[model samples]
Target: MYRHSATPRPYTTVVLAMSTDGKIADVARSPARFSSKSDRTHLETQIALADGVLFGASTLRAYGTTLGISNPQLLQLRQQGGVPPQPVQIVCSGSANLDPQMRFFRQQVPRWLLTTTAGATSWQKEQALGVGSFERILVADTSTGGIDWNNAFQQFFQLGVGRLAILGGGELVAALLAADLIDEFWLTVCPLILGGRTAPTPVEGEGFLSTLARSLELLSVQTIEQEVFLHYRLQRS
Candidate 1:
């Protein structure tokens, strides 16, 4: 995993639901509502275990709202652990071109924004007018105009996010995989196959060479009716 020697970052996990052919969404890039209620509950359990939930701009736009803990037992667990009822919902975007009217702004969970300088400038005017919804904004960009993930995770650690969950739209997961920042993955494979050339996968970047591909160690596998849940840990070098 990518770790800063001077700073301890959160233990990051990527949670996703994909079709049997490995498509997270259809060609239209619409919200992924194909998963069953069991999968939804599984996702909620993972979110409840995390200190923060992160998603890319595309995922946020598709859903228009972040998932909050509705299960009473999960809420009680968070209370017993001294964390808020809902984990901080974090949106990671480079441009931060988000609609303020989206239902996400009205959600009861704590919100955080992770963006670059240019993105932050777009929101600064709103914050000045006291119309911003984010409780915290972090700008962590690299010299090459990419996200400085190490720095970003260090900031997350400083903010008390010891465990981070990544809900994907593919691009974000690919970036973290490229940086070797992701630690674990929870993949739910549904029965259907969404066959489209433009469909999004769980990790979508230029992809890695066979020689440099990341390795994963299988942790567990569970089969439920029509879906299979696979848990894997990144095999760190």
Candidate 2:
């Protein structure tokens, strides 16, 4: 909804799996496998529909995600829809100090990096090593000292991205929420408790005060085994 140009931005959906205690990770910072097989299947389905999938660099480093379409049927569907066989994988970092040898860079899908001026300058010395063709999208904002997602997303729209899926590490999700850019949420709640003060949640930016919080309208809910999947539409003011 935070459109900067006359043309519309991509439809964005934040997809995450959290524990019953609302934690996406434990205190040890390990990736949580709280979701079941069905939940992962749902995520893959969504990925097939999107033109690209975005995640924070920390999330990619922590989970080692390639952001690929594993199902042959889904890959065919993507081709039929005129999108690439695999949705592009987009990673963001404030410092851009990512390990080029990581598995994420080895994937065949298109890859992009979203970063600030400082981050791009930091990576100027390294040469691309078959890291899929990369497109660096820079967002400069003096006030925030970070990315201006509204402008970044506008650039995405101009690049022919009609829909984008966000697979998160919380900070990116929070930024999109605060900027009012995400249109839907797909959350899977598992039957486990990961109680820790330092545990990561699905959203971790400057939270809105209770009175100023955005509202959500539950669109659908499904239960598969011990996991419950919830879909919601953000209700804008």
lDDT of 2 by residue, 1-237 (tens): 335436578999988899998999999879777688888899999989888788998888887756578899998887787778987788888788788777776677788888888877666555444443365555544465688787778778777788999999888998888877899999999999989988999999778899988899999999999999999988875
Clashes of each: 0, 0
Q: How close is candidate 1 to the true structure, as a TM-score?
A: 0.96
Best model number under TM-score = 1
lDDT of 1 at 199: 99
Query: Which 10-residue window of candidate 1 scores lowest in summed lDDT?
Result: 1-10
Alpha carbon lDDT at 110, candidate 1: 96
Cα miss at 157, model 1 (Å)? 0.5
Candidate 1: where is the Cα deviation over 4 Å?
Answer: 1-6, 129-132
Worst 10 residues of 2 by lDDT: 124-133
